[model samples]
Target chain A: MNSNWHEEAYYTIRTYEIDSKKQATLPALVKLMHESAMQHVIKLGVSVWDLEPHHISWVLMRQQLSVHRLPRLGEQIKIETYPSGYERLFTYRDYKVYDAAGELIAHSSSTWVLMDTVQRSLARFPGFILEMLQLAPAPELCLPRPAGQLPKMEKTDHSLDFVVRWHDLDYNDHLNNMYYLQWMLEALPDELLNHGRLRAFDIQYRAEAQWKDQVRAEVQHLPNGRMLHRLVRPDDGKELALALSEWE
Target chain B: MNSNWHEEAYYTIRTYEIDSKKQATLPALVKLMHESAMQHVIKLGVSVWDLEPHHISWVLMRQQLSVHRLPRLGEQIKIETYPSGYERLFTYRDYKVYDAAGELIAHSSSTWVLMDTVQRSLARFPGFILEMLQLAPAPELCLPRPAGQLPKMEKTDHSLDFVVRWHDLDYNDHLNNMYYLQWMLEALPDELLNHGRLRAFDIQYRAEAQWKDQVRAEVQHLPNGRMLHRLVRPDDGKELALALSEWE
Candidate 1:
């Protein structure tokens, strides 16, 4: 909140954003964090529009989120996001969510890579964007690393097939990352999803799916009481995302 | 916007709310109107929280909407909703969406009935709410009537079964109405969906679907290039909603 590199945004939990318990859903927090990221880049003059001429766009690769407790309906929440640093090809961003009472509710760390829209492959960092995200090196070392390669699923307990619809696409015309998580959550049992709660989650993206694409979401029960998930394209058999989630 | 009976709220298009063209989606407009209606009742001290103790809740019966144009992403728009009037069993509400320049972009009319949560049936209007929604009767005559009985489907061209997930439910513990519209949109052919555009719609709710229910969304192509839509529970075959849509 003190520096030009950090951007802060405020949001109120809408009725639709809550669950049956009247607490804000994890998807709501993800949207807020992403919105804050967009706001930060727009202010830094490196937004999608600014990079579009060069056919460059940001593609999310990995994300980790932990929730102390979900905020209740009508609660005013503040989101702060800033770049942690950039490695060879990935930029690190961290997010913090606080309630109106100034208590931390949730926090997240994400990794994104520059993509050449025309080539559909990772692109080198744009010098201008690198210059704007000047985070000190020491802090990046303390941040939790983005979810790395996930373990192979031993067996799939639940799986669902989803054909990407127009509503699943975002302004970027690509399926929003949030839908992947929602599909993962949907594969969970009603006893767990309705009765249990998501305590933490880690996800790593492997590919992108578009409208009308048939993608299969699979969930495996891990040995340690966690759930491992994957979104895979049925036609090409390409993995779209790999994830691990903890339930309370 | 001029009177206490009228509630106005402003919204900015979000990245997740727009289609590939960067124009706001119909579901986005629906959320805005509902949010504005919530704001209106909150101001009148008759919000859901206040009525919960009485085991009563508002249930949408019918809605009609027309769009002049969908707002672009990041564009600021204003939504105004007010109670148009109320008959013995139904309360009427109207919504208008305007862009920053004050040009009308979308308008809607809706009818709602009160439900007794304990009894699971229609309930008489509460005395307090009846006093707040006082509109002069003359203007009510000019407003378009809420969508009445819809023509039965001749034959379903496309159908999709959607198992209501935890994310699909709202604070009311019932499936959000927006999801019904989304499922209907999903049932349309990609040839019509990806290329064609929705210009207007009228929907009437027949029953409420809760979590874990498998509802089938079916759409039939009409002879006049329109579409007839229905959301029905596969168990009891209860019609959840009947809708008609006109596309550009």
Candidate 2:
């Protein structure tokens, strides 16, 4: 892979980004990854601003995030990102977060699909996008392409209903992906949140949830300390997203 | 007053901080002020971490924010803050936000109180805190002292119930002040939110809301495009906060 396709940025973990443990929260970590990708694409001349005139926008399809150790508040961390490669309908990107000591703290791999905002449908990746991205296949995979399908739980342990708020809607006028992880994590028992730390998260977005949409999140704890979370539109029973998390 | 008493920080408006109009949202602007205050206190050797060991913390009592114009997304802004003065039991601080061209976009004046976390009661300012802060009273104020009493609305135009989410709780274990503004603005009618921009916000915090608490926010639109917002605990009808906002 060519190194020119990569970009790096530095950030200081702010108090708002930390959880009760003073460590970065899962959603905050995911935000860092997204920010890194945004910065990287902007540098590549294919940012949202560059695509808006074309009525094109990028959307996340799936992501697998693994944490070695979460960075703490006030810590300076470096986020590095690169385009891994592109398949027929999906483009892959990878991100690595390193703490002040230059130790890898966390990494994530995500798949994205191009969308036609005006048409409200999936669109083929324009050749210009691929040309601008200049993606080169990585020599090795960090994590197996997020499981194609996360198993559905036959039993439910807990559930919560949420009305998508204006803040939850992003510039794209859809619920941001990070909020899915947030709602799922919030549905867990307090015992897990208070005592355990998130180690891994694998999530897939199935459908878009617009502002004011009612979402129902259900969670089922697995025997192996993992949790399966499914979010659906209560009115239509249409699945919005599926996530599996490992906590330690 | 010594100029050293003042501190300034620069921030680039992030995508998540903007509203549909592409301008910084009211809550995001409030957050910038909060972040500026936090940074200033930390520079003075009295950050939250410094007081945590003593089981004491800082809390916002009242804030009066005035906006000339909201900054747009991606705009670089400078936030300047300093201790304005201190009265009997209230410490006053002020903030001014300027756009990249040095145009003042917004300014705020706030009064704060020290709290004893363990006892959950208002506490007197420790002498050491005052000594460390080295506050020099500003020669002028940006806005008048927040009205001592905001008139109770006789009629309500809209109301919404919100169960405080985990994300709403700050490091202090109480609802963050910005979220109060968010909930209030979210409760406004779509026509108002889509057409008007916030001009001023005068808010007073009376009580704290804990996790899972049901908060009902009531908004009454005044004749002058102003709004009176009251947040209360539905079960006991205890008012947590009251806010008055002017829109243009």
Candidate 3:
């Protein structure tokens, strides 16, 4: 087996993956980052198919992505990912996206947890799984780990209520992470989304949202020009996700 | 160039494309069919890129899909498409999807109209465009042209109001055809969606739906075990689209 831990994958930005600005959407970029991570693990022989028999699966805990520029439609880009390191009850991974010219376009870091699918509880990492990954030496990341707790703002400048639809649910029976970013950005003023570009964003998932849940997205424009977003279930007042976005 | 008008393309169903039943969603299938048709037109040297300089584009007017079975996740399927014919103010195309075993899974037919993007009106088809296509003899299709007018049912058994979101808008600056199906099926009773599979469906686009438009989908259960759906804008009382769905 190769000692090198990093794996690379290439993707073409499809028209459907782009937004009205003709730039790739945040959800599309996140999907590429996720597929890259999956390919990396599959290269290590630890794919979801490999773990299914053990009744174990990997669940994303938190992710932070910083973009230099979003790719445009029909642009071919490369994604490089590697297992960074492990912390208590969480595994770390890092991703970097590059344009055709090898210029860095985006960088992201994510934390994942192993879960027992049947019991719906956190599961301890198996030694064999760790052995297969052969985690690379920790490298400095462009962005720091997402903050555990975001500061509460005085007032929400914009808010919208969204019903979790069938299309929002993934195979895991929970709302996909991309929708969190969608709802967050959707709540922003049209002037911002239409004119500006997303430069940096981080999301911390606190709880799983299921189908038919009414999610309320609230956003506050901070004094620093950053946007703070919170997605909560109105029924139980459960916070589903929190995010901070910076635009250029 | 060879005179053969038919074209074939292959697609691998991705995990994200499937629903709870592990089968491909209607939108994914429609996307594949649309992509296949685009590729076919491009091969004939009349792609959107080719038409952009002329400020002209092709817009879907109507489509009917009949499914023998929905493809499953990770399944490789073949899509065959060809220009069937051109009638008064409309060009017709047909598509067939086959599973790995070469068994027909679904078949679809669509009608399109040329649009003058700058004028926002239908344009008369140019003779050169027809010359480029070299339309083959019309092939027998599994489904006929979608009815111009769906019957107005007496009462709506289920109804839901949906606001057009940013994600719902495609490059055309209108609601994607797939979302029309999604919202229509979404309004159906859970018993129909969960216990039955969509066998045949047809939709006719009457008007474009813009972002933030408050559209209501009303569905009625026909005595023949079919569901009739109509989407209309409450503000102007204009019908956006009409659909009829058969479940097995």
Candidate 4:
């Protein structure tokens, strides 16, 4: 992607941001992407908080990350994000991660929706926001695969239960969507975690988890070096998210 | 503390770094303190990674934070760190947090030790490091209070169990010490968390939580607006850390 075509930011992988092998962890990258996207929106002259009086906030519906190589600890990487227009319900954004040499180390595409905080339902994109992000979608970028097409829960090979903690919450007082992704990855076998490097992953957030909600993350092995995962609120039997990951 | 007397850095709290009230959380401040200290150590001409050759690493023993108020979202704050001096086995460092107006918002004192990573035991400070940091201990500073003096667990008022997940592990393959503080705070009463503001907290690291350790966090209420906490590895009955917190 052309560097001038989108908003760009640079981040140095901090010591704590990396894993055992000194490679930046998935959570760190996800945080950067969100931060960058949020900043772009602010620069576009609208802050998410500006929608607060209207009881509206942007929520991630789906995100797909493709990692060619994870940056090392202290490695400075550049990120570029574009609010690549909107469809009927979801607004699309794309991100590109470049190394010092300007090589594309990773890229991601995400779909987001404006949520009605009070009603806990989807809100139509505001006309102002639509105009602010009306840039044409990147022809080179592909949409995150529809969440429905991702595998459903099958026989669970591994599972872990977690209670949403205060730190896991955001200003919305709901469990931040990022923790679901962390729990999904954490439910994987320790052997794979210690040995494998994640190459790509897709996450689709389906439901919101509240503070103190007891949630379970379950993973199933799929054919051909892939894994399918889901996070569910067993109390209500609501599936919170679905994800697919591949590693090598 | 005079600005010239210590190494300083400024950080603007990011969106996700704040709480529901838009105040920067404890974890955010702790991270900035450690980052500034690490950079100071590097500037003194030796990187922590350089110590790897000798199988040595620096470890936090205790930290005490006094917060007059927490900085809010989008606020730029200044942090100053001073590696005061070393005692028989512990090295002392102090941090001061200031608002944009230079008013003190928070301050912290920490005790640390060099550890033989393989042995996981305290190691004597290296001669070169001693020379680099021999700058006189700040006269105005006081040592972090002895951890043993913190209240012992009498009755557990609230408790929560957590499994050390993959993301919790640092590069050393041990649960990064910050998570203990987070868990300790998380186990508090939800009402207190929602309505109260934390005034101060002191944490002492006793042991490391490894990947997949099933750990339990217990908190006990004390008189005069205080609380005590302990994080334990239930399987082996090991106390990983102890903390005391006060709120208003």
Best by lDDT: 1
- Candidate 2, residues B98-191, lDDT tens digits: the string is 9999999899888888889999888777887887445655455434555577878777799988988787788766787888888988889987
Q: Which portions of model 4 show Cα errors greater than 4 Å?
A: A1-6, A137-148, B1-6, B45-47, B141-148
Clashing pairs in 4: none
Q: Write the per-residue lDDT of candidate 1 for residues A4-119, one digit (tens) a residue.
A: 76888999888778887878778877887898888888878888878999899988889999888888878999998888887899888889899998998888989989999999
Which residue pairs collide in model 2, if any?
none
Task: Give a tens-digit lDDT track for model 3, residues B128-225.
Answer: 68875456554464346555666776788999889998878876668877788888888889777666788989888888899899999999999678
Candidate 3 CAPRI classification by DockQ: medium
Worst 10 residues of 1 chain A by lDDT: A134-143
Q: TM-scores of all models?
A: 0.93, 0.95, 0.91, 0.93
Model 2: docking quality category: medium
Q: Give me the runs in candidate 1 sitting further than 4 Å from their true place.
A: A1-3, A135-142, A147-149, A223-225, B1-3, B135-142, B147-149, B223-225
Error (Å) of candidate 4 at residue A174 is 1.4
**Residue-level lDDT tens digits of model 2 in A1-248:** 55557888888887777766777877887887887777777777788778999999898999999998988877999998887777787888888899999999998888888889899888887878988556644448533455567888787899988999887887677897889989988889978866777889999999999988999889998978899999989999999999999988
* Model 4: per-residue Cα lDDT at residue B58: 82
lDDT of 3 at A158: 98
Candidate 2 has an interface RMSD (Å) of 1.5
Clashes of each: 0, 0, 0, 0
Candidates in order have lDDT scores of: 0.84, 0.83, 0.82, 0.83
Candidate number with greatest TM-score: 2
Q: Per-residue lDDT tens digits of candidate 4, residues B1-248?
A: 33333678888888788887888889877888887877777666545677889888888889998999989987999988877777788888888899999999998888888899889788988887787557635555644533457878999999999999889887788998778988888888888877777899989899988878999999999998899999999999999999999988
